[model samples]
Target: MGDGKSSPNPSSDGEEEVRREMPAKKKVVVVMGATGAGKSKLAIDLASYLPCPIEIVNADSMQVYQGLDVLTNKVPLSERQGVPHHLLGTVAASEEFTSKDFRDLAIAIIDDILARDRVPVIVGGTNYYIQALVSPFLVDDVVDDITACSLNSSRELKSVDSCAGYERLKEIDPVAANRIHPNDHRKINRYLSLYESSGVPPSSLFQGEAAKKWGRADCLRYDCCFIWVDAALPVLDRFVDQRVDCMIAGGLLNEVHEIYKPNADYTRGLRQAIGVREFEEFFRYYFSNTMADGTCVCGNCSAYNSEDGTPSSINEYEEALEPNFLEILNSNDNNLKVLLCESIDKLKANTRKLVRRQKRRLNQLKKYFGWDLHNVDATEALLSMPCCLL
Candidate 1:
């Protein structure tokens, strides 16, 4: 009887060991919210709560690029509380890091973390990045290699007239044409490019099971827990404005100044960052009018050459002008001052609008994709947290 009981115990222990060895579904935590909602802080704080180690994969499109740290609002290393952050400021500033790029890179990172028995915390305000990561379906997935390069090339699309592009899309895929606004040249171009590239109708990608389930919760590539750190619109708006002001105080101008170019493409790369383009007019005017000696060439300002003497060469003058650019903000020139003020105002306004748009998109994701988002209201925290904490 004792021998038989010991044999049964051995079998039970083997079953338990097998159960322990079985692979569990990988879990990923996504912390998403509007800009300035403390998503970074919350994601870092999660490390203390979870049983496993956590690594962060940044999903912010702009934050992926190197430089412009203040303008992009990237979480500083010290503020990260020693959490290993992946894909943060890793891309070249000149390169366009698209949603597809993010999805591919982030999945690899998340999988590696899971393989090591750690959770990946994806934190960012970029909704499309988050969507692409969790959903397997992407527009690029359908495109073949031959024409894929031309799919979203603004230069290639620019050559095609908007009306003609829409007409071409209508001819190739009328269902797609009717779904998008006629004036939405970008989408029109995308559809036409998709059809031309893959030799398939753009509308066909969404059919039957694919149409019903693509990007929905049932199609999620991984088990995900979504945390949306939200706040009241009024409170969020106020916080965003304050944050912008803080950013400016913290060397945002100098950062933007370093990247300013005469005809930089604002549609791509780090130049697409909000504060960069807004300051274009101010920088253009500043560089064009200010002399090497820091004298304003504008008719309204007095012409006072540098005490060190005017630069003998145009290049030398150009090099000397930058040091005095900030001082020009305090100069008596009303136009320069107005331009600077307007740019700052525009940055604030645009950021506020982005907050609303992000909130709406988050709501749409929940309503349409059946995302079970856990909302944590940070209104009180935003209202009460000191500037240093924020």
Candidate 2:
């Protein structure tokens, strides 16, 4: 929509008139990059440079949930500098927030901001969310009755094994089947459902020229200015390590403990966050070995409350547990210590992996979708600026 080329005029005399008459597309700035690359900071900083008021719409999948402020690295209100942020920590921790949901809400919020004469800055490392916001089509959107179709497909395939499902998908839509892993039963089932419901092969949806450039600039919903806040891998890796340590010290354990449950589902919602599942083994062992009757078994532990069995406050409860927690951490039991240390190391390692993955996906988007990303190097800032700012 913002291709920067003027429309051809029928006559030379009417060229100026046609140029003046054409309406300008609304501008939306999208700041994206790897995690810990300072996308949020850059989005906030754009407020001072852009002439109009700016509101940020978070596109990060994890940061959209209600908890794990430290784990998700959500910018604190004090650091937001009074800039309004939408869809940040607005979803229930247990609820699944999908790309469709994000696109629907972000479009509404962006429209509202544009109507108010303020620019909407989309910021996050989740490129899929940004892609959904800008692009009109989604793979799932092709089905008119996806829920009903999925139910019927599930019933029909209830008795089928994974191997059988793959064979069936290959028979009906070999192109789609070849694209995905044989182990990806969810995607296989989805393809089966789409074909069964619409009487069309799933592969047909992606066959046309229009589908080839699904998320390219020519097919965008808004005139988007994409900014990639980038940094050297070494710098990002070191920063991520320090950031994980800072998150741990900033009560990450307490947060994880609050949400920890035995045999909890870590495949969905906030539980899918990097820090949450990484400590599952540690917490399972910690609670079983150290906790008894809602109090630590360690002699150094104090009663949560003498008057009532319950804690006075959440803060006081956490404070009482902290010392006992530390004692267990320092305990002679090598197993517990190993689990705790391994979880921390895993958190850092996973975060670094996420950084690399996000960077790769960003490049893929630029290469495949023709995203004109303005790269802003942040290595200097990462070195000099406080980790909290990033």
Candidate 3:
């Protein structure tokens, strides 16, 4: 993420001479929301209130890619107000950011902050990204085999990509295939290692509804007090529209263009976060001097939904003033849910609710995302939840 390492610990001579001090560690606070929800803004403001200098551990999915200052709506440096942020714009376009990578990196940053008596505030709207930091979701290689990993390099295994991994998982553990993120190479490789080393699939071992790891209801640790910002859907949609407008106005197009020209790894890989694909449409459809709207004309676009937009990014994004975004947004995840925006407002509302609910559950579990699930969704109502959201 952010290559910004915490500076070396200063000699305690000056401060230590004054008083005997207790070893105090950093406390972490996470601000979470959905796309278009105000997460970074809140995190930035909250930094000023921490007991020590805040080292922001960014958890947004898109912000890690370098040079994407505008498209991912990279938090402006001025807005940071000088509070040092970790992991905002660090990785190049060619590199990939994985949850396991995030976990290892974050633990280091958090520990560094604690050693320096600072607070670490982890913030972002990407739910999974935040979970990677605070949760107990283990990503260890299949305990059954140690030699398997040693035999293969991470790049060699990861090169298989999620597609091949998914196919393999289906043969080994079909149930897990349904749940694992299609793009999650880490998990896939882990599963692949399991199959290659051990004879059975991981899902078969965890083959029960009681398998809490696969459950979606879990999120936060058991001791967290959760608060969620609530707003009506229509209002949030308006906010999303305005936010996207601001990104476009703030030179997001240029940032995307710069990255696109480089054809770097991140640009083609993770940089496809959100708006990058939309602008690709703009480049194609109105490449010449055509005074038209710079909106996505993909399949779901009102224009494509109405008639004109096409699929090819080079054609739709490059030629037009507005990139054809409908097709890009309408793409689906493994569950067939559209990866793109259905409604910005609904996305903001539901995802925020999801985060709030997760934090509440985590507080109950006593470990972030570590809870005893009896494997029933409706059963959640039976437990008396703490009064924190108010």
Candidate 4:
């Protein structure tokens, strides 16, 4: 469905002046929480009662993938309670989604709503994503080869080469060691790499830029509303149990079994969603074992098991436009394309501004953008973003 909104009416002081037209104002409400956090249920509830027509903006990392809704724990339309929603199940499972893409899409849809005058209610708790939707990327830590080697191999750290790197890191960026998990050889190696190459500690580089970047809202030049959902731990845990049960009921086991293969790329985009990975492991190594010996422990299985996610994959890619712009650019109808392109560009830009505005409030809390947060850049070498963002 689309945004249903009316144009805004802005009045100016009477000075015998000609009246300029007013534009529709965009407003958003975001529902955030971890899995099983009742985000969808709450969003639909708000949409039903609010004076403004409510549209849901999906912030879940996995639900954007077209057909994998079952394992991702997506709320069905029957479950949406008649509110018009956008951007859920919009992308094909085979495609890659970046937070940048989601940020752009959310902006566009919100603009469409504002043009008509409706409220956009963003839902779901892809935590980092909730931040990224509102803020720019920050690079904090230095990642290097030694960290990679150490994290990869569970080898002795006192080895001469590893110790040398450790000492070097201690001297240049001691705080980095303090911050990262001591057992996390990957991070240690990265800090050492930064120390080796830059001769400066990772801590020094991202101090301001590292975090606390969200300044005051309203002050940032926008009229907006922010709502945060804090579900209790016990309640959230129960919700998770129910959600996992639902996934199993929805054929998540078969889904995992289908993807369980040596040739299968479990690391592929939507396939790496949380439950997908767990069950994939359950199937490949654990399933046959369950049938053969009936247990989860495999002392002899190969060591590809990792709890880290398919962050790179589990996002919505850019959606295609009406193609009129391309046709115009091709001189096949140039005038129409230019007009549409300009219009779409403005909408997307305004949406991005609003998203950035929202990120500031969420960032200030520090729970969502906590010191415990990990930087995406340090994890990967590419220009990429989380689906929601932190």
TM-score of each: 0.78, 0.79, 0.56, 0.52
Rank candidates, lDDT, best first: 2, 1, 3, 4
lDDT of candidate 2 at residue 380, scale 0 to 100? 98
TM-score of candidate 4 relative to the true fold: 0.52
Give the local distance difference test score of model 2: 0.80
Clashing pairs in 2: none
Question: Model 4, 268: alpha-carbon shift in Å?
Answer: 4.3
Worst 10 residues of 2 by lDDT: 317-326
List ranges where model 1 is wrong by over 4 Å. Answer: 1-24, 145-155, 159-189, 195-204, 291-329
Give each model's whole-structure lDDT: 0.78, 0.80, 0.52, 0.49
| Backbone clashes (count) for model 4 | 18
* 8 Cα displacement, candidate 3 (Å): 52
Q: Candidate 2 versus the native: TM-score? A: 0.79
- Candidate 1 clashing pairs? none
lDDT computed for candidate 3: 0.52
- Model 4, CA-based lDDT: 0.49
The list of candidate 2 runs beyond 4 A from truth reads 1-23, 144-204, 209-213, 291-329
Point out the worst 10-residue segment of candidate 3 by lDDT: 381-390
Per-residue C-alpha lDDT of model 4 across residues 78-103, encoded as one tens digit per residue: 76778887878888776766555677
Compose the digit string of candidate 3's lDDT tens values, residues 245-314. 5554465555665445323232234554655544443343332212233233332223221233233454
* Better TM-score candidate (2, 3): 2
